[model samples]
Target: MPNEMNKKQQEIKEKMQQQKYQSKVDNVTPTPPLLKNICWAFVVGGLICTLGQLFTDYFLGLDLPKKEASACATAVLVFLGAFFTGIGVYDDLGKRAGAGSIVPITGFANSIVAPAMEFKREGYVFGVGAKMFVIAGPVLVYGMVTAFIIGLIYWIRQ
Candidate 1:
């Protein structure tokens, strides 16, 4: 009767049992303190925000309009994201900081640059650089498309 179970069902049950036993054995007598997580969250969040602020300042210093400065900040973040992505350092930072590395302009930069870099490695003329726009291209197109649609809707409403 017990061996009458289906193969898949038996596998699932075994996996579940293994997980239950592992959880018990893996349990440490002394768990790490909560203060570490809180401190990490603050430090990571603050560093990310600080970088954003720095970019804002840099853009303003260039005599750009406020809106323009904001755009510049985004661009800078995307660029940094792409660059760090190329260097492979951002991934580690992302792991350590969690949202800290990702919730910023730098993350955007990383997103755009990383793919392109990957393509470039395949072939300079045909690789990552050419494919680099794969990620940001859609974002740019979507932004423009949405803006146009919104403007059209507003105009029609007016």
Candidate 2:
């Protein structure tokens, strides 16, 4: 009768409210361990900058212009990155240090050249060099495209 129908409606409403409350409690996400390692990344990245500074100081001490010293530092870092990457030591370091190894110029070099090295192992001319730039190429193209669009907008506004 009417009393039975009212009881059923109350039961459904109570069940729905309980489910909503439970879902709200479950929605909170716990932090992952990987994110906790970000501190080590900052420390390693700072060390990399220190090395660049040392190189810049040395070049300046040799009477190089300020600009030249900076260029020299950049070149040295790039060379080290490429050389370490070629010997496969960079990846090993990355494994041990996690993001620590990834926040430097050397890391950037490794990012670009590691894929190329893999391809080269398959066959130097036939595989590697052809794809040496595969990973970096898209990034470069996209960066350029975005930069161009931004520049065009700026020019038009001015």
Candidate 3:
């Protein structure tokens, strides 16, 4: 009797497997709109660059030194990035805008602050401070290391 039950179960399992395979073969996934995504990313990225340019121009119009004005504009942008991330608006923007929202200085700021804010519930010391660099720390370290290696290469070549 147990042998009969075992044989029935194996037949049922084979039928189930065949149905699953047939379902997969019948299902067709539609292609994503890659070109549309690219265009939107370009438009949004251009808009971000335009905003930064406007900020720098505005600071220059105020008679600030060129270098100082650039620094000030960057500072404001970074602050805005961190603020938006803290308020949870930046995440939505990033999702919709894709690379348009990232690939900028503001995005770097957002990356750092988002992790810190996420861990804040753990406590200030272990939470915010410790996790603040979780995302950005490796980037920072690698950037410096790459720069040093490049400098050494240049120096050696000379």
Of the two candidates 1 and 2, the one with more favorable lDDT, higher being better, is 2
lDDT of 1: 0.76
- The most accurate candidate by TM-score is 3
> Model 2, residue 23: displacement in angstroms?
11
- lDDT tens digits, residues 51-140, model 3? 888999999999999999999889988998899998999898888677887877788899999989889899999999999999889889
| Per-model TM-score on C-alpha atoms | 0.55, 0.67, 0.75
- Best model number under lDDT: 3
Residue 6's lDDT within candidate 3 is 100
Question: For candidate 1, lDDT tens digit of each residue in 37-136?
Answer: 5566569768777887898899899999999998887777677777778779987877666656655667667667777666766896678667777777
Q: Candidate 2 lDDT, tens digit per residue, 43-151?
A: 7777888999999999999999999999999899988988999997888878756767766777777877888778877798767767877777776799899999999
Candidate 2: clashing pairs of residues: none
